[model samples]
Target: MNWFKPPVKSLLKLDLQHFGGSTLFELKQNMATLGQQLQKYEGELSQKAIDPSATLEDIKALQKSKEDIKARFDVIKEQHDVLEAEQKASFEDKSNIQNIADPKAKIVTAKAELIRATIRNQAVPKDVMAVLGDRNSTGGEKLLPTTMSEELLMEPLVKNPLRDISTYTNLRNLEIPKISFTLDDDDFIADTETAKELKVTGDVVKFTRNKFKVFAPVSETVLRGSNVNLVQSVDRALESGLAAKEKKVAFTKTPKTGEEHMSFYQTGETAIKTVNGADIYEAIVNALADLHEDYRENAKIVMNYADYTKVVKFLNNGNSTYFAAPPESVWGKTVKFVDAATDPIVGDFAYSHFNYDLDVLYERDKNVRTGIEDFVLTAYVDHQIKLKSAFRIAKVIPAV
Candidate 1:
């Protein structure tokens, strides 16, 4: 049920874009104001009934006025109810934990087991062990809660710049077909029957996902006694570090042994550009122009937050007090300022890809001297930017 499902004129009054998912707030404020108007009309009507000079026409007018406010209040209340339901439904949609049996029971047991990984759930904990028994012959009882899975797996797709743009695949270990650096030189037409297939044999680049590990250290007492929300709270924050590392390597790492692709920020990594222009603004434009037309349309200029500030500062130079700037885009191309990488890169991200089905492994290390146990999570991730010439690397020398 949409809040804007009213008559044409009434719906026109609704500023959906201006408010941007603030329909509920508008409905709430409208209802409150309408309710107040109705109360005012009721008070006026009562006073008119007590006064002898008050005519029937005046009393009738107040009745009509009160009725109008009441009708508006009903409409606003209906809109509020619809929007509230939508919000609740969205939260309900992210339940990957439901894939497991007795999800609620498992979450409860999981929290307890995380506090003390060494102990088993005596009353019979669930199948997180069975799920991983294949990987580890003897598996542990700790299962990540449904809420935690959403934070680590689902949230990063929307929140992390590198993760968002990279193609998400489930294949943990696979060969990516290499991007051909040079075009087939022979332009001579071959007879259709005798045309031989493009003859290169070693055509694929291999990418094996590597395991990333992070730990949250807590005292034995806090683990066993503290609340679920408080103890080992940094478990969720680990995703950011994992995500940052992936992005930096994808966009900057020189190809290691058996790796064929190059990241954008490396010199002559596919295409490299130096600004021949006099000023910083022209340098940015030159970087944008350096990318091939085939890639530039979809390309994003990835830079540091500090570098992006230069664009904003340039836009606001004339306005000392009231200033406005474009929303992180230039020349119709999106500009991404991310925490993961510092050097500027412009490229069509379709050429970049990463595997996504994060399988989180649990481990623990206990220090007898400190009475502290560290809960370590391990996950495997892979990334590559396959296409050459689709990316351009640039370094801007700031004005003196």
Candidate 2:
């Protein structure tokens, strides 16, 4: 479809007199929507054919074209909005028609214009002028300037009566691409520690008497046995009234308690990979040797380690090429690979961006003729992986 040439009248005509308040709102919305649609369709239509093997100069040219179209669309939409609002206001306020002729109206209008002039001179143009215009006053001057017309002075501040209509149209007239893909999740792991203490006690009795014992008492006889098993065995033996009572008892367990020691930790390795490439995927792994190194990293930073095993093969069978992947466990790394290339060309061609604002010559045109191709492999830990992220590539290559 030719987007630049929209059938404006056929698409935009409406019966303003019959449209109720609600319909007027809908019309306003449609105009706003039309503004956006004009820009979008123009952008899509303006896109240039991009060659996959194009050089930096070529890419820049294409970008410049796209940006230029974007700017044009923006300006065109603004103009459309202005025209639409002016049309609606004329329909809604029949009272404004007489203000152009009445002397009293002219006086009020001139006074309002004076204030607007003062404000523009004083660096405050909006507040008082807006209020004066609301009263259908010419915006605050006793005598309006030749440059100041009611319509001209108020054009910027007018509200779009077709707002609702423009909004509906915008909603109904959007253009964008859709994508679908699979997502995956994994697990998290770490190391940790704990403590215990022990206590032991033993008791025995010694013979005691006053400073000078009046008489000597008979010595108490004691029996010896395996007292380790019995808690009260020693006490029982000394306090026993009978002469000798020895019993064998055995304790197989230790008599003390214990507590385990506290545990401490040292920092461990967390390897992350930042992947980027064309047909072939290249992972730039930064071992995150220290906090200092980690802070210096960018979008390539991954939180945890990954194996990053990659397999490369052509979508269709063709000549194979080899390039070295970055060494495993490299910190602060970089990798580059030339993926798909165009068939050999005969002469140096002028290459430019999709916008075609600037062009460059590709010096090594012959070296990459045979359509070199590859893909990248990126393996990241569960925590390191970000879900539902989008990747976009804008490549432009010129034909021979």
Candidate 3:
């Protein structure tokens, strides 16, 4: 004696025309409708079997109806699953595009192209130039590539936040020729005495290019299974890897290789203020004060995430917080976080210069079958942390 519950109908009745063709929404709605019908048929069949006057013919009819509806329901469910997978892939592609600095115009253009192709019954390109193009195409429909979500994909990688907050210049050549510093001190004292011989002194600092490369081996299976934008994904991965290395070099006194660039933290002992018996907020203020007034206006604070969390927890009397929950910034300036083990640094990054070639080169090797294909990405960049004035930056080191 088994009892079956009636199928619940969805209140949402979507119009087919309202949803564009071959869309996720339309497929999902179709699936839901099929499910409701299948459920209704099952419930009717169950009730008929329990009816006292029900004959063998009545039961058999109900069974046949139930089987027919179930078959249709299964087909729609399978379609729904496939559409869901494709929709998920599209979302991932969109996320990758969003991470790029300026992608709105490109996205708009790509969408327009897709629409035009659909309307004209023409072939839509699997890959879009503006964003990473899809690699899988079946018939006229393109399949979304499976790839890691943006959060998980970018979690292990690091990007230089300073790139967003600082000025950038492109170098046409390898070296940047510029005067490092100039000084002219000559005083006029009563035309009687020849003005002290004019004294002019200066030197030049040349920034040269450093070649950086990252080698990543991707399996053919993963590439095909994920259906990811291989070009864009690899580019992003390399860019992030390079930026992380750059950030490390920018903050270190001595880089592992190549020319050493002076870091903001190497401001000498005089420019370093120890947080002795002072609150974190006050310590940061003292650090900013150490910088000249001209540089102070555009100064930014950089620190480790751990220290930043502590700074945000600072409280006023009565345990009231001075900052809004999860403060966006501190000291009226942008705060950038790094994976640094050292103390916080406050300085004007405008004086720090970084130049790079606009072109990025890629080399692919399929013959060197090392179990999978290998991709080599390379970029040329030159960076120098030159402080126009020694007093324009300060480091806040906590007392042991």
Cα lDDT for residue 368, model 3? 60
Write the residue-wise lDDT of candidate 3 on 148-201 in tens digits: 122212233336776765545554463442323334632322221112111111
lDDT for each candidate structure: 0.54, 0.24, 0.51
- Candidate 3 TM-score versus the reference: 0.50
What order do you get sorting by TM-score, best first?
A: 1, 3, 2
In candidate 2, stretches whose alpha carbon ends up further than 4 angstroms from where it belongs are: 1-52, 96-400
Q: How does candidate 2 score on lDDT?
A: 0.24
Which of the two, 1 or 3, has more TM-score?
Answer: 1
Off by over 4 Å in 1: 1-115, 118-124, 127-159, 178-203, 220-222, 225-234, 251-263, 267-280, 320-323, 356-360, 367-370, 397-400
Please list all clashing residue pairs in model 3, or write none if there are none.
127-133, 145-226, 145-227, 146-226
Worst 10 residues of 1 by lDDT: 189-198
In the predicted model 1, the residue pairs found to clash are none
Per-candidate TM-scores read: 0.56, 0.18, 0.50
